[model samples]
Target: MTDAVLKIENLQTYYGKSHILHGVSMEVAEGEIVTLLGRNGAGKTTTLRSLSGLTPPREGRIEIFGNDTTRWPAYRIARLGVGYVPEGRRIFPNLTVLENLAVPMTRPGPWTVDKVLELFPNLGTRRDSWGRQLSGGEQEMLAIARALLVNPKLLLLDEPSQGLAPLLVREVFRVVASMREQGISILLVEQNARFGLEVADRVYVLNDGQMIHSGPARELAKDEERVRALAGVGGKEDGVLTAKPKTSAA
Candidate 1:
């Protein structure tokens, strides 16, 4: 238990024709809520894909739960107790809530069907409901519950709040915070900077597939300009994005 839950060094990834990620290094401590903050097309999702072995890094080191699984296949990495909830809540449209969770059942962690239902009571009420019948928030809860059922040591959630309503967004973060209290290491990639920082212990800012800044998440909230620049906030409405570098993170 003396190792970081998830660690990456100089992680680089490619998407076919061009290289995406540069030298990116970061770590998530056990039971800590860490976040990767960036805008659209900023390589945030690509980073998660790389870590999960979905988009294997061309050059880098990825260690999950103290094991060097860089060269391992996706199934191999997944079986090692790492759960990934992708950006879209990819639920089985025809399956019920319980059925969806049962799809990836590994079981060993502190999570159980009853406990997960308790965590999100609405799920219990909708157990027999089809995935397509639930609201966006309900679908998100189902995704988290399904991941928990796998008994993951580390959870990688990509844009959990994307396209959710304001209230549902708050609910999502609250759930994340509660998960941290229960000792889950979370790597969250979020476009909503305020929501991400609110629940994260540490935050990393990635630009053009390279990490530019990382520190206590609170420090990020204090610097409006820095947040605006690296995080894709405060950009004009021309849709022609320009890089506006600011002071580096200390």
Candidate 2:
């Protein structure tokens, strides 16, 4: 664990009156693409939120780059070399592309507007356009680029492939895959098992807010029965499975 970039030990989280995660613990090693794979509402987003301290786990601990920041505020956690690109591509709808990309800059060593545009030329072409003006794919690219501009050591990505066409999904995943090549560690939460497993070095599957499966991405991809049964992707529907996500320890 000496080289672990992010660590969660028996973490528990809550949402007002509801409990969500249940003794959940995981780790992201430095410069690796590790994904949390789950069905919709399997506490994937909440896990990312807890890691980023947006919703701090009520129990257990969160460590970023070996520093304990369990009680830190979201901004403080963000300042600890962690950047999160949330689900739904939560960019500022009213801001221009340039404005959105610049909103999260702290000291900025490498990720500049010109540089991000160079990486994503389509976004460069729409630099002056409003956030809402871009398509879903374009907005996702913009959101990710904005996070990278801060030179974050660990990136928490929630459902980066959601709601995009196959072509755009490929485009975004390629960008994510490239982040590892650039030596940026990633903790990705994704529902697209196929693509998630394809790029991930390691993966964890969450079911009913519990860690039911853990293995190399390739192994999980090959287990058809497990993929269909516990994953909620194939076979008879399980009535116990619900879409309302809660925060708890898993």
Candidate 3:
């Protein structure tokens, strides 16, 4: 409890009549990179959404630094230091990179506009460019930089490498690793099991709205068969994550 930046217990959430999360529970400890891994429809994003109050849980508890925030609104959750970078790189397209970074400044401490620009040098060069003009990788960087501007204690990242090239994916994961080095706790929801394993200290797998596996990332990374089976991927070999072949529906 003392070291945990975010904690959830028996969390349940729904989207209209569709049940999304069922008794999902996990914790992100201070300065830890905890990845939530699963296949396409495994409720990984829902878990992060639930944590950030984007889709409030119908049942269970959410605590931020020991304070219960289950029923808090999204804005309130953000104020409580829960920064969420959603599935899409949802930066304001019409706004400049600098403006997008300035929009989330509530009560910032160490994360200033200049500091974030320095952290993301590419963004610094493109500060005056409209968000829509940036490339996919740059957009992803901007999304993360915008969240960091909030000076959050817990950062929620959903699919940061979803549509990136291999080189860009590596770069994105490197930034994620760097964030952990800076003492920022992160709850990353990713479909890329291999990439997630590379940066995560701890890993949890979610399936059909429930957490199926939880342990050290390295432990799971070593067991290729188990990772393939759990995450529906071809498994990592020679430091690369090969995609699993798709099968016809029976």
Best-to-worst order by lDDT is 3, 1, 2
Cα TM-score per model: 0.89, 0.91, 0.92
Per-residue lDDT of candidate 1, residues 105-124 (tens digit): 57577888888899899999
lDDT of 3 by residue, 142-200 (tens): 99988988888888999888777788888888888888777889999877778888789
Sorted on TM-score, highest at the top, how do the candidates line up? 3, 2, 1
Alpha-carbon RMSD to native, per candidate: 5.7, 4.8, 2.8
After superposing candidate 1, which stretches have Cα over 4 Å from the reference? 234-250
Candidate 1 lDDT at 153 equals 77
True lDDT of residue 194, candidate 3: 81
